[model samples]
Target: MSASPHPLHELDPAPAPSVLALVPAPAPVPAVPVVPANRAPRANTPLMRKEHRDNIALFRYQVIRGAADPSLSTRQRGPLVRALALVDHPWPYGGTRRFSRESLDRWIKAWHRDGFDGLKPDERATAPGTDPSILLLAESLKREKPNRTTAQVKRIITETLGQAPSETTLLRHFRAKNISTGARPVATGRFETVASNEIWVGDALHGPRIGGRKTYLFAFLDDHSRMVTTARWAWAEDAIRLSAVLRPALETHGIPEVLYLDNGAAMSDKSLARTCAKLGIKLVHSAPYRPQGRGKIERFFNTVTSQFLGEITVTDTPMLPGTAPEAGSQIGSLEELNTLFTAWVNMVYHHQQHSSTGQTPLTRWEASWEHRTPVRKPLETIRQAFLWSDTRKVSKTGTVSLHSNSYEVDPLLAGTSIELVYDPFDLDGEITVNNNQGIPAGTAKPVDIGRHVHTKVINAVKDNDTATNINTGINYLDLVATRHRQSLSGAPISFADLHDHTTPKNQTQPAVSEEEQP
Candidate 1:
């Protein structure tokens, strides 16, 4: 029976009906016409009505792209944002426009979290609450007086129009128009002097830490030549360090007619005022928080930061000419830093052609001197000008106390308030006694000396001279220092050599032996 079944099944296979015919063929899809790469898709073509918003988004993206780079570190981002904020961009709607720093920062942050879509302005459900006319009025009021407050502008608008927008609304409008209370004018022209040494702008830059102590740069720039007249890095920003830098500058480059400075404690000290008055140099301080006339000095500082400070580090070996220190070199001392800076200023900065003046700073300076001589003062006069003064009433014993040190004055000056003028660095030395009318009465000899220098001078010495063993070979500043010493070799008054050799003006002094001439 199994054999018969197998034979029947094999015979019933009658040419297995074509199974392939039973399956249906897929219907042909209409060929999708490929759009060219440059052509927009038909379904998503941009409309003219949306072009303005698109342009605005594009503009914002352009402004923020540099600051929004994902790979940028925080330090890089900040400078890019600031640089972008300072640039004027061609506006899509019309004239040029400059974004505020805050606005630029906000846009960059928005772009970082979201893509290009984030830069587009959000669609408003309704028009802004402020009227166009009201905004125009607020802008006009701000232009008329930049110091006007938003509240004042709002009050005036309410008085004139009998109704006004909120102060916040007015403030926003003012900001949009770049006429906010804090905003500077767009077209303010640059200020420059007619000739070199006419004006010297001075400023202090907080610099890198050396030997675990912060450093400060005291610098002065010539307004006409853009020359760095004097620059020094010190550990302290005090009147003493300022004098140390400024005195040399006066001696080397001659006196400036006007010394423009900021209102810092170091710059505003009475000593600086007295020095200026004695030199016949007008001391002008910039308005508080207003750095209008200091652009040249600031630009020079930027150059120093980029060209000089950027290339240098703490190093033991002298840097090669036209070469930077090896990577990871440590700055050994402040003296080395000063030496390196002096070389850079003399070799690189002085040689480069300044963009504003179209001439090298050194060239411009020398050219100015060809036509005019800089005003200069005698060394004695300068020394007397920089002397520190204090007023004290003489006791019954004919003594006056200054900085915890006692000095004996003429007996006639007893019980009288007199001005004691002396070198701050040498409080142990003799002091000149001036009567109330500023007439020299007599010299005050040190009776009981404790501190040899003023408290500020002590602090400066501790901070600045922390590491004095550094040896830098053959630098421009050292040569200048040598020349300075040589020039003063014949002068009897030496700051480095404090001796009690001053004799009374009325008394005749014995002539010194040839062997004791020094």
Candidate 2:
């Protein structure tokens, strides 16, 4: 009764069904492939960079993919687009920064096409070694005279290429690539003087071709300051050119105590030595086979080669004369080249820290400010000293002959030996006549000549025409007299024939030649 104890557990509720037993076994878990340990881990190498770049590139891919999806509305796209520029991402080598969405798009394409390898930076296709002129010169130098001394090879390369690699860069390349001609190393032991203007070393460096002609740079380097005194590109490496560069340098940088140079013919000329002596500069020459003495200037020239000329020489842009050049190429003439070099020297080189002196050349040169002692010679005297000179005796008529032209000298200079100082191009501008004691006698003027010495060769044609006019009054009077006489003598006077057919009756006209008559 009492429901039999409410079924007293009703024989226990039937056991609940096992949910785990009823559920189907999960699909076998996918095995995560383990990377092997022995494979060299790319640490700080380009390869390691490639992996990080790949992940970043994948992210970019996903971003772009979401952008193309119609499901991503403007609300979603706006922030995503803004985040590309604002959000910082790890860059491979240059450092971490935000990239342009466009750049991200490019990387994504790179990775999609080439996989991880595409993410690596591409090697530069244009290196100094790959330059056609440099390579040809290097190979030619090695082949022509195998086993040339390194120094000899260096000189050859410098002369041929108009610039040569630094000794260290060249030698490293030579050893690594077997391009060295077996040769002895350079001998060391050099003399160095202190103070910026105390000593200056001068040397010549071949320069890149301008148009069809090659150039040679005559330069002087301040030993103490490492400052380039003056540099000019010349077609000839002679005393004239050297003096041309030296005079300006002396004027600007002050006279050096000693001028050191190699045994080049131009450097050893008596004219340079005389000039140096006159300026109180002790001219010193390095012993044969001793370039170490001029190491400063040589290194300076090397810097010009590597820093200035190298950048210009690597250009592949063709520069045919008369043809317009591509942008960034100012290499049209020697003047332009020097203009560029001057700007570079005054603005860039003078301001930069030198590797050896740890000071800018201008700063170093200016540092010992009180040490400067410029020459006191009059500018005219300095000018005369630098210019080309010759002696000629004035004729009795106060005239002198030079370069096959007659010049009128001072009346007092007549029948006396005098020195002629003048520029070769300025014959008409006249020249200064100095006595044997170097005192100015007077100025000489070139005699007038109707003919020009040299006519310009131009591509255009010009007209050289002449005409003559004579008064017709006398002829007209004679005609009138004849006509009156003919009337008085009863001869016919045809008034119709008295005037020109092309002119009015009262108008005066020129008499026509017999050949002009119809």
Candidate 3:
């Protein structure tokens, strides 16, 4: 049975030649050549020289602008052409020989069809020979008195050649003559102060709505230190709100020499100017539409928007727990918003290194602060100095009218003119009435004249209006020693001296009093 195997079914017959290996390899593929439609613009390839190129560019810009200008009327072509021809046109390459009427028409048509690039000559393998006349014209144009426009140029060419030249053609010849048409480079200005607190920039920011009402943040930034002196949130962008913010900053950081402000509602108010005048603060407003001077405050606002508002504002996704959970009560209370903002400012912002200062704002401020002497004033003094004042006579009811509200005043001041020092937005509606002697008579609280029509007594003054000042300077004790010394001499004494004294010496007193001596 083993010998009966068929030979056609050989167990180890050689495999048929592999078809893939046997087949001849296809011819190597040829890469598709990439042909550029246009050559790159070369610096030296243009017909016009460097200066002439800019002139041509300026010409082109002028024509393009004129073409689109609704001011030029096409109806008076004759008069228009006549008027335009009188203008002294500048041509860089040479005299405006190429600027002919027919030329202008053709170029303008081409421009209409294909925009700016259309005015350029068709591709030429070799640079066309430069025209000396055209070159001369371009130079003259650049130097031409009272720079000329395309139409005026076209008219001039017409007058000289008896046929108007093509504005488009002339512009094309000088296309790269100059880039005078390009926007002027923005001039960078330095607005920083040399020393910290020398200058402060203030501006108001429109913040997220609270309780369906818009909120504004008034902030002051020290230009040199890049430190925000104070920031207050308010419902209105009024002078009163601004004063509230500015006073605190003045108290804490001392007064800035110059207060750079914008011509906005908060800074432009008359009260703000008056306040600055009183404090010897030079209030400077940036030129209208110019924000270069307010860069510091603007930058601060940018930081606030990105860092603080981004995290806490109700508009953001990651708002505080109670922030705008509902539309009725915006963002937790303003107190909460203020609390969070203050913490960030004191704990985070003041400690961070400022990009401009290369030191933490507070640190940089302190560095200058070492050598600088800020006239630190008490908050009450600042308030008193910053108050808005106007003279008004007290009424028969011992009252005065302010902002349409009547205030009850001292009966002694009845029918007397008094200078009222007050916060315009006095929460308690109280006015500090000062008599002619500059004495604080009393607080005039808002009263309903109708409510007190028949009342004989007026209790407008607060019981605490006793006006107690702990005489920090020149106290009785200071003069007591002088008095005792004078008693021994039996003459008058003036010990507590307080005039022109930048620094006062500590006075000494005898251990035992005169009366206690045996």
Q: Which candidate is the best by lDDT?
A: 1
Alpha carbon deviation, residue 8, candidate 3 (Å): 72
Give the candidates in order of TM-score, highest first: 1, 2, 3
RMSD of each: 27.1, 27.2, 31.0
Model 2 lDDT per residue over 326-434, tens place: 2122354554445445545554466668767789988877776675554455444554455445799989999988767788988887888998876433445557889
- In model 2, the Cα lDDT at residue 298 comes to 70
lDDT of each: 0.67, 0.54, 0.53
Would you estimate the TM-scores of all the predictions?
Answer: 0.54, 0.45, 0.43
Question: After aligning candidate 2 to the native by TM-score, how far in Å is the CA of 300 from where it should be?
Answer: 1.4
Query: Ten consecutive residues with minimal summed lDDT in candidate 3?
Result: 509-518
- The regions of model 2 sitting more than 4 angstroms off are 1-189, 235-244, 263-280, 283-292, 314-332, 351-358, 370-381, 394-398, 410-416, 437-440, 448-518
Position 222, candidate 1: lDDT: 87
* Candidates sorted on lDDT, descending: 1, 2, 3
Question: Model 1's lDDT to the true fold?
Answer: 0.67
